[model samples]
Target: MCSGPEADFARSCVSSITSSGQRATLLTADGVRIEAARTPRTPPPAGPAGAPADDLVIVLAHGFTGALERPALRRAAAAFAQRAAVITFSFRGHGCSGGRSTVGDREVEDLAAAVRWARSLGHRRVATVGFSMGGSVVLRHAALYGQGEREGRTGAHADIVVSISAPARWYYRGTASMRRLHWVVTRPTGRLVSRLGLRTRIHDRDWDPVPLSPTDAVPLIAPTPLLVVHGDRDPYFPLDHPRMLMAAADPATTELWIEPGFGHAENAAGPELLGRIGEWVAARG
Candidate 1:
């Protein structure tokens, strides 16, 4: 447990490790230039003489106001990298990626692009893990293109999905954090603040077609393994959100874990939890 300047330095070192990953530029179906990185897995200690190493890839989708360089994102990526190859990317409006954010609406394309890139890299299996707004993106992406079914736009589906601290529905302003987020995305003044402070360019208009809600997308992710994780004390969306997602999903294929004291998203996701998630993803492969 590092703190103060030491913690910042530690995070920077971790960020450098994540940044050392092979960088790639991915074009979404909508022609958005997405910035992505693929971190190769660290080789395990010699076990048998020539045991084949696991070839699994985990694509990480970060929350609103997050990017590939964010310390939390880097830390999570490093943890996942311990068990499998890890891919991390900034969804369009954040970091070096192009275009504006439509929140979770068009971001599904971003997640899809990252997953496809991972597949193209020759990984035998690919799993998706998302935090907050990204959580919603993974759920919708899986719904649209999971279970070996390919949509014309997004070619491949993720083999496994994990959603953390995601909202069940859109336009939810139940908590102070969410209310502030709504303001940031809805108002011009808030958008300006977001641009200057958060380095995010939010789309001016509302979602055109209104992409599927996480709960609505849940039922569609059958035969494809799904894990819905949420903090019991999450401020943005209460336990109802994960409960709603789990209820809508197929019981046989979905698993739910409501953490006791966890807060929200990547910031609250400690290394221990990330390791467990990596283990879970590895088990799937």
Candidate 2:
């Protein structure tokens, strides 16, 4: 399966399963410590025959400054668990995870670590659903790991990818919210506020070599199914971002949803919309 160093650690990592679910400490390829939790699907109501279980697992990636314990993220995880097992983790620089956030860059290794853990749990299929910053990470992860399996990149591949409220490019200052976010990540004083107020640790260093952008990554995800969901009322990124991502992807394998009244990522997603997303992943993943 996953042959990288991270996957090696994932395979060897000890996990404890309880009535609640499985919990463990994961090590990324770069030795970053990550906190992760797993929740099995909620059993359906009684019927003539019990609902057949599927081997699908969903790995959720949270937006910038978001964590597994956040109420919004917890709610989203619960909704997805209705259809399949769910894995939610705090990326490095957030929560108890060790490391600094390089924003969307290098976070792909954190996601790979989680996916390898899912495989270790014996799940036959993996679906990744990411929100905002996490959305961009999923697109890039799919491009790098979804394909090239035969070339020795295997286990970390996602069968289906769902990106919600992701941006097409980097360093976007078009929106007031984004401009403020840039300040938070770039200024020392703003970073202090982010640490004390938002509890997120951002890396101060800039990218030496820029990673692939979401639009560029989408083109390489051919044959892998992708779902891009965006909100017209989103404050961080505009409709143009989602439109560009869809345009870069293969039409035969891509699906786009532009919600009229929806706002942003997990925080803005209502129960009804989350249910629909769960259904979509269940049907295809």
Local distance difference test, per candidate? Answer: 0.85, 0.89
Show model 1 residue runs off by greater than 4 Å. 1-19, 45-53, 147-155
| Per-candidate clash tally | 0, 0
> Where does model 2 exceed 4 Å of error?
1-15, 47-53
Cα lDDT tens digits, model 1, 1-285, are 112331132232222333467877688989887778888887767675432245679999999999988999999998888788889998977877777888999898899889888888888688999999999999999888874364365446888999999999988988999999989999999999998789787889988888888999999988889999899879899999999999999999999999989999999999888888888888888
Against the true structure, candidate 2 reaches a TM-score of 0.92
Worst 10 residues of 2 by lDDT: 1-10
What would the TM-scores of all predictions be? 0.89, 0.92
Best by lDDT: 2
- Report RMSD for candidate 2: 5.2
- Candidate 1: pairs in clash: none
